[model samples]
Target: MRRVIIIVLVLLPLAVLAVWIGVRAHRLRPKSAIPAGTSATAPGPQLPSPSSCGAAGRSQLEHYDRSTVYDWLDGGAAPYLDHGFTTSTVATYRFETGGRTLTIEAAAVRFASPRGAAAQAAAETPPGAAPVPGLPGAHSTRDVLVWCRGRDMLRLVSFTPGAETSGPFAALARAWLGGTAP
Candidate 1:
């Protein structure tokens, strides 16, 4: 009976101390801190998207010689071409640089549109010319030219078709643009 009493006395005090330390430690932690055992090394606010990043999506060292841009292409029939079977029309862009004119949009044809080839071809035909048959889902496409001189890169992007993306995609875009990634 005496040994049992002594053992309880020692264990009871230790248990109380342990409970006190645990409560104190819990209260001391910041409300914002992630719980222990979380996988992420650093956790906090996340970026919305890469597009929001200043130059993200928009290329760095980007500048286009507007003068080099020659034509706004529309796809349609090629009844006018020498080797014609109602092929799509090719819009031409003419440019003069270093005393040499370089055309940019000579290859303006849609080879694989869901719409019938006829409709795809019709998108390019000049409006005044005899109206060409349009494909069911044929669409007029608009593109932009961006040249990153330092990178020696020429990019053509379709902005007419507004894009849809998820939160993570937006965050990634914003990050690439300039914001911090998630």
Candidate 2:
């Protein structure tokens, strides 16, 4: 009986974790096509091209040309790119407001489907992060925001210590996708 109780205790958390992952995967799965000829120029449900990644141009921020390629993301962010990572665009900006200087880094990643992108976003989100204000269901890890729209995964990180950046990150996310994803 003691052995049985120990086995149940050991497996319970694993089972719960599996269920949670499964649910998240289901929630982030790609939606079905809207059918052909439904409406022209309504913005196709297809993934946005990496070349079309919008620039972050808020007045409070100074845009910088410090973009890097895929090889640079091979370290901590490599696991999140497991699902059909085609291309990515990155931008770094500096925000100075109210006697505070904050450095912001944004990356837009293109995946095969929204599910892949959302899964990547979920994978990158750390525990205790909350959903960003403007972007619903998007998480913020104190200094970073992770979100997905259509087939694009967007990440915004504040490089400055103790910088509160949920609002700016949301704005950058909007700018990166030209208003919203798809």
Candidate 3:
């Protein structure tokens, strides 16, 4: 049983990561930023391409700085990982102080509780899925998921790929809900 335990332990995190990526595929969002404690009443402008939540039809919005992201991060709905790792995001602001220069494409699934959110994320996994921002040969070292919590919160940030590691993604998530980054 020790061998099974060790295998389960080692794969546990990856399983979590897999589920994270999986559910992400189904949770496509719209561009209408919804405010908390209220239901989404309308939609906004849409970005082009895969930016659409291909299926889950989640509401979407994008921000361009860290300051905006911090507002919600401080609101208490921070991101937590499987191994007891949690984040308290301080802020999310611009590095270049200009127009958005990076693009972060994201789709989020929200929850009333952390476990609920995690379970929802896992439960909604997409079939034959891969990384959100990667291509055939590119590989990422960490599991990066862009999410937002709360109602009517916007959750998408886009920019030119060549731009710096802009906080557009963080800002997008913040504009809609609360979350963390990789």
Candidate 4:
């Protein structure tokens, strides 16, 4: 009876450890970025390929320096992630013209759901932000422009000195919605 009791205690702990490890492994596994054939998991709109953001798109816009990618997941993206933002990649450009420099950042964000994205938009809307005319799903708060369609959210920020952020936020939005790069 003594030997049996010791065996039971040891085995019980080993079983518990095994179950804990299994649960952790399942939780840590990576989820597919864009699931296939499922509306719930599908990202709303397809963002342009990074290659599409080359010179052709850059030249069409004013003050655009060059096309490159920004690490949104590491910067300024924590807040959005907290809401419902899932996978995302950002394309950035440096706009230097007329002795002024402005930074342009654009990204297509996939939220957990379309409704979640809309809710996040509403929550993040700044007070007194006006709807952008001719641009659906767009709002402008100071120098920041945020828009959403389906399950995707797009953001454009113009970092120009002073409050005068007359950059290419509109053009970028148009291009993104039109499935092009700018």
The number of the candidate with the highest TM-score is 2
lDDT of 2 by residue, 1-182 (tens): 99999999999999999999999999787555542211222222232222333332322212111122233453544554567666565556666556776677776677767888888888888788887666667788768788888787777778885777765666566656574442
The C-alpha stretches of model 1 lying farther than 4 A from their native spots are 34-182
C-alpha RMSD for every candidate: 20.8, 20.3, 21.3, 12.3
Count of clashes in candidate 4: 0
Task: Compute the lDDT for candidate 3.
Answer: 0.35
Q: Alpha carbon lDDT of residue 165, candidate 1?
A: 18
Order of candidates by lDDT, top first? 2, 4, 3, 1
Model 2: how far residue 141 lies from native, Å: 2.7
Single out the weakest 10-residue window by summed lDDT for candidate 4: 61-70
Give Cα-based local distance difference scores for all models. Answer: 0.30, 0.61, 0.35, 0.60
Provide the lowest-lDDT 10-residue window in model 2.
Answer: 60-69
Write one digit per residue (lDDT tens) for candidate 1, span 1-182: 99999999999999999999999999887756543222222222222221342222222121112111121221212322212222122222333334543332212222222233343244343344321122122222223332111111112233223332122222222232242332
Task: Give model 4's TM-score versus the native structure.
Answer: 0.54
lDDT of 3 at 106: 49
Poorly placed runs, candidate 4 (over 4 Å)? 1-83, 96-99, 161-167
Residues 54-152, model 4: lDDT tens digits = 312332121110111113233445556556666654556555556655666665676778887787777766677788878877998657788888887
